[model samples]
Target chain A: MALIEVEKHEVEEEQKPEPVRVRGLPFFPHFLLREVVVMCLIAGGLIMLASIYPAGLLKPADPFDTPSPIYPEWYFLYVFGFLKFWTWDLGPIPAKMIGVTVPMVLWYGLLILVPFIDRNPSSDIRKRKVAVTLGVIVLIGILYFTYFSIVHH
Target chain B: MTLNDKIYKWLDDRFKLSELLPPIVKHPAPLNVVSNPLYCLGGTAFLCFLILVITGIFLAMYYKPTPAEAYKSVEHIMTAVPMGSLIRSVHHWAANTMIAAVMLHMMRIYFMGAYKKPRELNWVVGISLLLITTTFGFSGYLLPWDQLAFWATKIGTGIAGSIPVIGGYISLILVGGNDIGAETLTRFFAIHVMILPIAIATLLGLHFMMVRIQGISGRL
Candidate 1:
């Protein structure tokens, strides 16, 4: 019975029309040409920027004297902002711990779980209202926090 | 045969390049992806990575990881070594550009919903890549042993050390002691120059392979 079903399925497969190929440019010269152009522009930009404004080197480190208004890299400024922003203690957990964990651990955890959390199966922006809104909110929050860090510093 | 044809034939006979080249050369990249500038973010990050690696290797040749000599070495590279300032500056700019490109690429992926269904694992890999990239910036930031580098790292590590349970260990592992000193410098050097590179390269290989196997997400 299984063999007969398999054979019938094969016959149906044979009777179907050929699948249409996806319309696109070949990877060889056509696709590569655009890539090469973009690469050239980016490289040119980097070289120009480097020539105009070189990287700086400050005075050697003095452990005894701490610099005021010190900050982490720009990417990490949001975390610093959050730490400063979140000052309330939650039950037993310290505010400091919460500040660090929320930005560093929880934020990344949420990011990693994004696919699993939003199972809407739709790629259309119009259809994914919830996901889009949440994403925008998060982006705004990060940007605000980053700004806060700079201003407060 | 001409020299080019002769060389091609020789390589083809030895390595079966004739059989291998067609699939790769003939593969179709979707028309939308080809035309759209949005798809270029990841590639921009990759280009920055390549530039960083090349410039990093040159910078590494002159960099001294020891806390005592680290500042002097970077100063030497900046002022004394031939084209050293240019190379170092390029590395700095590329590092910053790569981080920015990665963030923009993530934003593109998120807003486009490219992380849906079959692409879930690739999204995870991408997040890991972002973490590694930021960590790269953090470790590299301290290499110059300047006032900004020292104090920034101190605050950075202090923040990390404030986390709930495993915070102490993370700080210890990163700093290699109670404070940022010779050990911390060496550890950061090894991480910035060695471990992170190896990890990122492997993850990048897996990331690209998955993209190849699955093909780019079809949605706009």
Candidate 2:
């Protein structure tokens, strides 16, 4: 009976509030609302404002009057730059698919399985230098290809 | 009032305030609230959303989307409107910035290992949101109807026709026919203004909820 009473006392002592290492907020190390709000406002307002005006109508689609040197949007420039390969008029078909579909499929596949692949939980992306480096290299290569295509044409 | 009644009134009023302004009590710091690994991605995305909204409205007063008026309208804004050039420049610069930022945000989530386990579905939703955002960019690009914008979109929608299933249908829907015409502009306009915005907002809300519920993932 004495031993049991002693155990209860120890449990009560352990139950005392411990000092948790937290300051202002639980998640944010330093919260800056003004900057965050400004960023969001700019993004939202652009989309809404740009929504208004488009060249009201398009000329009927004409297969004959081809849009010369057709190109993708700027963001896709890195991929569309692949078009130059088939531009010799030799194999534009494969080049187009290669330019678009391959990258899409590859990225989608990687994204889906990334959790299983990167088992380690690391906050520092740069620490996984091999993988991160490869991504940067790939992006640089793609951008370079785009610039090359532009300059050559 | 009786003493019992007065105490009951005080309790009810106090509890109501707690319910109404819980965040003031829970999270007095915005950074702390936003820093959660789970919430950071979309929260930051929301930050960009607000940016897009502000710059967009400033551009709207001067923008005229019709073909005849497209270039002229832009010209008028640049020349006639106050700070027109700045507004245009800011809009253009910010569009590029958002795309870059969003891509980085996705990368951060990917590297932080936040898109794991229960977060998988949110990842998929996020991917959808990215695609929509890009589409928003593309459709908006065409609004200026500049030589670059025109040809870029022409080529873009052409690519849409390459998809295996419903490729032809998509092309038609996009252009309102095989060729770009008034209908195409109108359709793209509807999509940019009406359809896409609603879809994005809904997806963003759902995406946010998932983030809040899952909480931030642990940092290694």
Candidate 3:
């Protein structure tokens, strides 16, 4: 009986995997060095772009004279595109309300509920087919809408 | 004591910065995430925000909030105010870059499932921060008082006006009246400079604290 117990212990010990050796440098200098390098690159890029093509000052605003194709900044183009697409007449529901609220709620709701919606413990993208698909679809939709808005405008 | 040690002791006695800073400064980042440059988007966004704040302060020195003076002040900055164009351009580009960086960071967090379980609150905080950042952009957009700014604001506020019950009231409050005028400029200016900044800074502190406590999420 004692020999069997010892044999069991030996098997358990043999089965134990090696400790994971995480690959990276210390935080103080190693990570900090990378952070500083990235920050410098961003700064250099900003300066180069700013110097090369200075931001323009458009004509002073005249409330009376609206531009022919007025558009919000590129970031807002997705929302602008949604508003443009959902122009159907709703009797009681205000069009702008539907246009703005629906997209806002849907986009933010998905974002806020992501953790709950994806309960799987695994972080691997391959295992998260549903979540990845949804994310990709949303991203593509936004990009498509933005591009459409730009071209049509 | 040596001169450096004496100076350090003197400062440390007055402000306990020595006690406060080391743990934070030396906190070990997750090896996998830190190894990849992609995970630095949040930090990059933060750097851009800092740049925006500095450039914004410089611009504000000469910026007049009134509708009458707003456009001329921006024009003044562009053409006359020595190195003013560079500063203004930097601010403009920084704002755009900050937005892009924040979006990229959020996308990275989402895909990595970083918001799962214990990190849900941080995710909510992050989304709120994104909203505040967008509001910052919207409010700041109107500051130049140019054609694009004016009409864009009109449409933007009009969207706010479309909210079901309180939309009219909210828009009224935003524009400060029935129409976009001096009051509108002042309100947007106040929001861009004062309100949003305070809100974002406070939320950013919370976000960073949560990230520190939880540590960076594991890579996918």
Error of 3 at A67 (Å): 1.2
Candidate 3 clashing pairs? none
Per residue, candidate 2 scores C-alpha lDDT tens digits across B1-220 of 9998888679878787547554433432323343454445455556666556676777766776566676677777666887766567556655666676677777767656568677878888887788788888888877766666677777777766765466678788788876665676677767877788789889989987896688655553
lDDT of 2 by residue, A1-153 (tens): 011101112234557755443334421222444445645665556545544532222342343455666555567776566645434332545556555554454556676566667655454666677667766787677778778667655
The candidate, 2 or 3, that scores higher on lDDT is 3
Q: Give the Å shift of residue A94 in candidate 1.
A: 1.3
**All candidates: TM-score of chain A:** 0.88, 0.54, 0.77
Candidate 3 at A45: error in angstroms? 0.7
Q: Write the per-residue lDDT of candidate 1 for residues A21-140, one digit (tens) a residue.
A: 567777777778878988999999999999999999999999999888787889999999998889999999889889899999999999999999999998999999999999999999
Indicate the residue-level lDDT of A124 in model 2: 67
> Model 1 Cα displacement at A67 (Å)?
1.0
Candidate 2, residue B82: the lDDT equals 79
Candidate 3 chain A lDDT trough over 10 residues, lowest sum: A1-10
Collision count of model 3: 0
Q: Which portions of model 2 show Cα errors greater than 4 Å?
A: A1-72, A85-95, A105-113, A116-141, B1-15, B23-25, B28-45
The sequence of per-residue lDDT tens digits that candidate 3 reaches over residues B41-158 is 9998999999999999999999999989999999999999999999999998998999999999999998888898789899999999998999999999999999999999999999
Instruction: State the lDDT of candidate 1 residue by residue for B12-128, as single tens digits.
Output: 999999999977877778777876889999999999999999999999999999988999999999999999999999999999999999999999999999999899999999999
